[model samples]
Target chain A: MDRLSEVSASLVGGFEYNCIIFFCTLVMAVPLGLVITFGSMSRFKPLKWVSKTFVWIIRGTPLMLQLFVVLYAPGLIFDIPIKSRMTAVLIAFVINYAAYFSEIYRGGIESIPKGQYEAGQVLGLTKPQVFFKVVLFQVIKRVIPAMGNEIITLVKDTSLARIIGVTEIIMCAERFTKQGLIWPLFSTGLFFLAFCGILTLLFGYIEKKLDYYKG
Target chain B: MSILEVNNIHKSFGKTKVLQGVDFTMERGEVLVILGSSGSGKTTLLRCLNFLETADKGKIFVDGRLIFDADNKQKPSRAEIRERQLNFGLVFQSFNLFPQYSALENVTLAPKLLAKERADFKRNKAAIYDEIEKNAIALLDDVGLKDKMNNYPCELSGGQQQRVSIARAMAQDPKILFFDEPTSALDPELTGEVLKIIRSLAAEHKTMVIVTHEIEFARNVADKIVFMSEGVIVEQGAPEEVIDHPKQERTRAFLNKLSK
Candidate 1:
């Protein structure tokens, strides 16, 4: 195959990096986000302060800057080489997304009325049971749209891994551009648009399913 | 013998005393109506009985066991408080049904969790859930919400939500039920449905302590009426004796104000 044909054929394989980043970050970040939310909401002052400070620092800076730091800072400061480009990307992306997700989780959890917890207690539910069985579902339902938006943003964010040499789709397209082909770079946008469109539909269906929670 | 006992229950929010030296007891199957104006501690008394509000000073007994005593054990742990919560069901003024759950789920949840806590239920988990579901459906039918079993609390009207909560209360087959002005959050028209349900429960001779301003309903259903004023029970007797032939000035004044 010529360069164009090869580029066309290789698009799926090249984009695999973005897919890995997207799904891996999502699978790890979401539960980490919930754990961070619990830390932020902890009754113990120190845990809450530490959680808030960590989130504040991540959210205050750019993901690109965090990526640079995650890639170079350990090697620079402690003489420890981060050998895997993918590992650094995963760590940076997961940390950044988890900070954002924790805030959304916190807001969703707090928006629930105190009456809900009281009703659970009155029914003799242990506190953990009340949280997991009753409150967790509501939080998930309420935060889905917000989470969906973040996940879509993540598809675009996977492009940032290219800066650290992850050779994601955008990087592949850029290589094609160096070879005097502009079509692949533009076509990458089509790939994202389809991904995002499918995600939007999935989220719309979820929000519809959760229509039972008009309260 | 008394099924529920509260002795000198005292609670204060900051400097404002809510329940001052409140005392009451109820026999099994007796309906006790706690009648009081706002700020008179009727709601606080009910909360204290269920360990919702820790009493600053008091002793509470459920099924002849000392569940709480402020002086004896000043700071009960959450686990201890939770253990005490198992003895009674509470229906809130706002009908605080688990909004995320359907009417049937709201009725079945606690009982299901309670069942899971027992060793026997572990062997027959499916049977436990089925039995609880059947009872919950029957209870929802009893509260006239059989058709609305799959509806969420937000989907139901205030009266219907209140009815669902009443069914939710009966899910655990509580030793006694507590109503914290169950109709206070309802419209005047909607209040009738909740009142009717309470009337039916009273007829069934269910042990209940209802803190309400519904004088007529209270009078008609309560086996014992307690009138409170300024965080004190100023008068208590048979509804006819207390409402119609009250001997205390505070009681007469409160009734007169309500009447007007």
Candidate 2:
């Protein structure tokens, strides 16, 4: 029992890295995703094409390979020193998740009828004001469910950071397996279930809060 | 000068012309009711007047302030057009209230937003909000939705929703209001409530241009009536003269068809 407790205590330190990767990626990616969504939806043809192709490449490639490229490309191709492995994992995860979230944002934006925009126009609202005041929260309400699914997937995806030399919980648990202890590895699943359960509850509460918006 | 003047309006949708060389002028506080069949360009003419749809050829002036002049080589900028749109209010058949806003918020949104944009609003923020809230409540009450101030659009009935739409347009303090098939989407039983609200608005002598299929309501409320067929105005006159004794054969035939 003491050994399990000791293992759990050590895993907590490793799990901190996983939590940091998850939150940093999310905080950076969501706004970045909206920015990319605007770029993809821009009226300027070249900008739209470039933004779409960038998202396509990021979404098409394996996150593992992207991590490798982001981590090593600077050193090999440009001779620039990369001092932080966490920076590498964060950049790869942020770019990958941003592309996925951008598509979700696009779908949410497009689902709004044109008449809604026209209604705002007739009210003398500027385009930006119309988007922020009338459409932004509604878009957030619509994309929340899709975003919730992606966020839950992100909890598990944090394990990918371990492969990039970040000693996250799974990696810490793997050390115990090497010492002929498998229970700690199994306990990692419980940790993940707790994390995902909290996220699911949070999203469900948000959905109920926005229930007034039927569309 | 008339309150609104549209000279030689023309519109086309692909191969089919929708509004062909339409000319019109409305006096202040005159309720002009347009009547026509579904494909007869009545809604198109109304939409064009409100700048919701741009006419291929036309010039619009509201109280001698030029709103749109398609014939001019130097076109007005987009900002100019949007500024003119603020002078008019449009109500859709679908009651297109923001699904997210409460009934009162729907009425207050534009006015509140416009107030906030002024440089001096920050100095008198509370007063501005209070004034808007007061007007919103009054308008909601006027439309018989005093209790529905907190209800979202989806929560309201079709008749109640259309009533809310009328209040929303009235909230803008528009010089002229335009309605396109306001009660067309409502159930036959629900339309009476909407028509009643409009009848009261007409009694107030508010300038209005309405496109509707309600012949009796038109006869009761219209200061003048226009009859259109196939993208052209066949005739326009006092409701009694047009509805009871239309001069054109097309007008007579349409009135006959509607009564039958």
Candidate 3:
């Protein structure tokens, strides 16, 4: 029982790191992703091309490799290192997840029928009003499922931050495995499973709430 | 002076010319019904008049004020275009109500948004909102949709959805209302309720431009009829002069086909 308490105490500290990374990445990525979506869908050719190319490169590459690059590249390429490990993890994770989220947003926005825009315009709604008042809620309703999938993945992906020496729950469990104690590592799975389960319930609730939006 | 004057309107998509030098004039309180087979530019003409599509070449005057001048070297600003668009309202073939909002919300959304631009909005917020809500409920009731005002678009039938869209259009009280094949998307049994509301609007002497395939309805409701073929107006006159005694061969062929 004493050993179990010790293991639980250390895991809790590591889990705090995971939660911080998870929330910070989400808080920064959600709005950043919307900005990127608008950039990709812009009518200006150069801006659209840049945003598309950036998303393609980030999505094509692996997240683990991005972590290494973000932590090391400024020092290697520019001779000025990213000082904080947490900042590096956050920078890489936010950009990577934002690229994925932007594509989901693009799909949601594009799926709206042209008739909606014409309807809004004929009602004398300016372009921005049409987007905010007419289109935004429908897009939110459509993208929720896809966004939920990414969010669940983000919970697990937070473990990858350990590669940059920013210790998370899984890495803390790994230290116990190295000492020939395996039960704590197995216990780590409970944390992830419970987190994902709660998220599943959350996403299901959101989808039901938006059920009236059939578009 | 004519309430609306569209002169020499021309539009094309890539190489396909949809509207070529179409011209017409509408008096206040006149109902102008446009008839044409599919791909004959009737819908495109309506779209151009509503500013959904900018004409390649033309001039449009509303209330004797120039609204669209394609020949002008500089394009109109977004605000300018929006200001001009306020003069007309369009009901689409498909009832494009915002699915997320209830019927009452859909009818009131545009007016409330426009109301925000008023100088007295902040000081008179409660009164302004109450007035907008009252107007929306009245408009919905006028279209026989009083009971369905709180229902979402998906909860309503196709006819109910169309009625809500008509109420949405009427909320703005436009100078000229345009319908682009409004009932074409509805079930036949459901068409009567919608047509009845339109006939009542006609009886009220509301100026309207309608593009529809309902020959009998057009004959009964139109003050003037314009038959278009191949991107141009072939004939336009009073209903009896144009529908029963068409001068152009194209108009005659169209009426004969409809009769058969």
Candidate 4:
């Protein structure tokens, strides 16, 4: 009982770090992904090429390598250091996951029937109004399941922040293991399992709310 | 004077010409039914009239305003062309109702969008809602689907969906309505119901341009019948004159196939 309580106290700091990365990624990834989707769909050849190339590079490379580069490269190359370890982890995550999310978003938006856009134009809706009023809900409905899967994976991925020396839950638990207490490291599973379980329930609720869009 | 005119319109899609120097004109409140085989460019002609598909070369005038003139290459601004578009409404064969909105909401969307840009937008909302509700109910009542206003497109039958589409087009109160094979997707029983509604619209003197394969419906309802073949207007006159005593060998052959 004493050991469990000691490990739990130490893990609280790590849990906070995990929560920050989770929230930050959600905030940054969704909009950035939308921007990337626009870029890939752009009519300008250079802009489209640049956006697609960036997404390809991010998706092609390892996330761990991205984490190291993001953490170290700014200071090494430009002398403008990214001083915060948590910020560096966030930058790596946003870039990596934004690429993935952009593909999903592009797939969802492109899957809609072209006839729908023509119908909107026939009603005299301008481009922006048509997107927001007609296309946005359908895109959200189509993309939700894919996005939910990524969000659940993001919970597990928060532990990768420890590689950048941010004392997230696993890193906190690892500290106690060095003091010859191995059980604390295993007990960290409780925190992860609980977090994942809650996330599953929340996503299930969201899916239910969007049940009107059966397709 | 003609209310709408299409003069020498030409359109093509990447090496395949769809319309070749087509010309037609409609006076106010004229129901013109265009008959054609598949790929005869009937729908393409309608699309060009609305500027949905820009004609490769043509002149289109709506209410004496030069909307499209390929010779000068000077056209009305986009906003001006859109304003002219308000004069006509199109009903597609596919029943392209905005699937997300309820039928009533679909009926109200365009007016609300237009009203939003006006100065007295908010003050007009209630009156617009009343007008939309009344017109929607009347249109639905005409089509015998008044009870399905709140229903989504998926909940309705094909005929009901098409009726709702007609109601949505009528919601704008356009001067002319365009129908592109409106009954092609409906079963026979449903087709009868839609035909009855369209016939009634004709009776009410609502100007309509219909592209259809239903020869009997065309013979019964059309003020004028235009037979098209291979991207050309082959024969045109009153239905009895064109369908019964066609001048062209092609029109007679086409009618013989339809009877068989």
lDDT of 3 by residue, A90-203 (tens): 999999999999999999999999999999999999999999999999999999999999999999999999999988998899999888999998898899999999999999
- Which has the higher DockQ value, candidate number 1 or candidate number 4? 1
lDDT of 3 at A151: 98
lDDT of 4 by residue, B1-260 (tens): 88888889999999999999888888887889999888999999988876689889989887887767877666667687667677778888888887878887787777678777777768887886677678777777777787888888878888888988888888778878999999998887889878888999999989899999999999999989998888889989999999889999989988899899
Q: How many clashing residue pairs are found in candidate 4?
A: 1
Name the TM-score of candidate 4.
0.95
Going through the candidates in order, the fraction of native interface contacts each one reproduces equals 0.83, 0.73, 0.85, 0.31
Q: Model 4, stretches more than 4 Å misplaced?
A: A213-215, B71-78
Task: Please estimate how well model 4 matches the true structure, expressed as its whole-model Cα lDDT.
Answer: 0.86
The whole-model lDDT of each prediction reads 0.90, 0.91, 0.94, 0.86
Q: Model 2 segments beyond 4 Å from truth?
A: B72-79
Write the residue-wise lDDT of candidate 1 on B40-69 in tens digits. 988888877777777899888887899888
lDDT of 1 at B172: 82
TM-score of each: 0.94, 0.95, 0.99, 0.95
Full ranking by TM-score: 3, 2, 4, 1
Cand 1, B chain, TM: 0.96
- Highest lDDT against the true fold, candidate: 3
DockQ winner: 3
Model 3 CA deviation exceeding 4 Å by range: none
In order of the candidates, what TM-score does chain B achieve? 0.96, 0.97, 0.98, 0.95
